[model samples]
Target: MQQFYDFKINKIKNLSSEEKILRKKNLELFYLNGFPSKKDEDWKFTDLNFILGQNFTNIVNTELIPDEKPFNPINEFEHNFIYLVNGKLISKNFDHEEKDKILISNFDYKNEIILYRENTLNFLNNALAKDGFSLEISKNYKFKKPLVIYNYFSNSLKETIVNNKNLIILNENSELTLINFVDNNSKENFIINTIDDIKLKKNSSLKSIFINNSKNNAYFYKYLKNDLEKNSNLENYILSSGLKLNKFDIEVNHNAEYSSSNIFSALNLSNYEHQEIKTLINHNTPNCQSYQKIKNVLNNESKGVFQGKIFVKNIAQKTDAYQLSRALILDDKAEFNAKPELEIYADDVKCSHGSTSGSIDLESIHYLKSRGIPEKEAYQMLINGFLCEVLEKLNENNLKKFLLKKLESQIHGY
Candidate 1:
């Protein structure tokens, strides 16, 4: 393990003595476990240690100095934008929003606290993370347009690991729509470990969308922790399809009554690509609801996995939770795994989970072909319809159209 990776706390700039000590301690702890493998229950389906060892012979952490690059804004719809180069905030524009209603700055590394001791990735992030952003929306304010975070990586990043942590807070009665757009075109094989902490205050609402612009050779892992207060609502839409390797570990805690959350994901894995989405939703209060729907289309020996669990507390009466995973395996070598669980202590709660995976329906494809559609076009149409169902509940028209276009491109493997 020591021969494959090299990490030093001095690489991070501007740290106090105590902070450096804490970071070194975390690094030692991470070295004890290295990368997670099948032995870990949370990572049993995906052996990250073996995967990284196969791809990278040597990995190191380095400081990234932002180089000037042409910034392209998404013209599909009106939006505020923030540009990030290798996880470092570079520039931002909020012309469509009131300046006083939004707050944006660098991540607070000084006040960091250790939250997750069980996850080795979290420990690695705490030790090596150097760049990230903190964003907050003022109380009672709603953005006039969605905010697009452009995540761009430099072309020179090869065999380097980038770790970062982010924080987002939505005050009471505030609402915001955020889009995390990955715009990396680097052909280099690198690793990215990120942790995001999000808090939604009373009556606040947040809609988050994740998408990739093109295919790349990056390995990505993100752990997101969400806290929901009374009457708050959170909706997550994930359409990440172009990465070589990826995993998303999401944890949502319904801290107060009447809170609700929805997780919808649509993934198209081609060739040897692998992706997984793991979620744990905790209903700590009464009358909280959660819904999750995961859809995957695998082709040419690709792999996909979904592990979702819902927990209800003893006092969480009337908790309603539902989760379903469906996969369309287009090739004999393709694979899909699903593990759905429910741990309920409240007798008055309602929860159900199900998973289904199978090959594409030949009868439907033939029917489309007979209706004058070309065979290739028939297959594409069926796939588009199969994965687009997850986006049906999105009310934004232009955003939905943009996402649909991206999803189509990924399905065609362009």
Candidate 2:
């Protein structure tokens, strides 16, 4: 860990005087705190021992850079593309004619927005990040094609720990869709941490989709802190199918009136893969709303976890919040854990939360089978219906189709 401090000091040796001072401050704060453990309330269920125990003496040195690499874009979409390979920005593509309509920045650290202060993971990202990116959508601007970011982890990574920071901003009345696609092909054990700071100005809206199809040897964790101003809205969708252990901790704040946020997560894990989705929704102002729904299908000895909390302050009257978690345990060895909480201080609020877990209903299966349907087909139909509740919320057909394809590949034989 001491070596990591030296690496940061050396990495920014060429930077401006101000950058050097700020980077060192962040690194020092992290070095003293270390990583989180089971004692931490939020990280109680998830353990970082396996990855942290490695005691990576030094950060991995990689030749891969995001601003120079060439990669193929998704064929069905006509959107801008950002490519990140091995924790570094490799390429960003915005149609030449529309380049001015968007703003893209990298490795240019900003001191104003320090996210998740005192949190070990957030500090670690800033202290050891290879590079970072910031994306902003201009005011009153709207684009049909979504912006897609592909994060690739190659199999060559050995005895390495990667960290990345991503920031996104939307001006007033601007609307856009952002997709983060993680493709991990690494065969050896690897650890990567991502920290994202997102702010939505008044009346702006953002639709975020995260698709993870990592390999079994990778350990991936992400922390996202989002702020929503007045009349702004945000929709978050997460689809996870890989990684030896993966977790996404997202905290959303309704900073002003009339803002709304909704989160939909679908996780499918087989073999020994494990994933956890933790969300914190804060209603700080009046007349705001939030909702969360999570669905998990665990196979073999796989494990899934969902922990969500909704906090309503006194001034946040008339807040409407809802949460639910449902799990389908395919094999007797599979596991699912859920903790949903609501803390309300206002008298005028509608908040509810519940979790349910069970195997395929034999009565429903028998009913379908009695109508000449095969047992396997009936089971597939049931699973599809259960998972579609979340996928159907997607507004874009292209994204919906892509997600459906991934879901089909995982749910077919279960």
Candidate 1: residue 343 lDDT (0-100): 96
Give per-model TM-scores: 0.98, 0.90
Q: How would you encode candidate 2's per-residue C-alpha lDDT over 161-234 as one tens digit per residue?
A: 67778889999999988888777655777677888889999999999988775445777788888999999999
Scored by CA lDDT, what does every candidate get? 0.93, 0.79
lDDT of 1 by residue, 204-251 (tens): 999999998789999999999999999999999999998999999999
Give the TM-score comparing model 1 with the true structure, all chains together.
Answer: 0.98
Best by TM-score: 1
Per-residue error (Å), model 2, residue 9: 4.7
Show pairs that collide, candidate 2. 66-89, 66-90, 66-91, 67-89, 67-90
Q: What is the C-alpha RMSD of each candidate to the true structure, in Å?
A: 1.0, 3.2
Give stretches of model 2 more than 4 Å off: 1-25, 31-33, 50-72, 110-115, 371-373
Residue 189 displacement (Å), model 1: 0.5
The per-candidate count of clashes, in order, stands at 0, 5
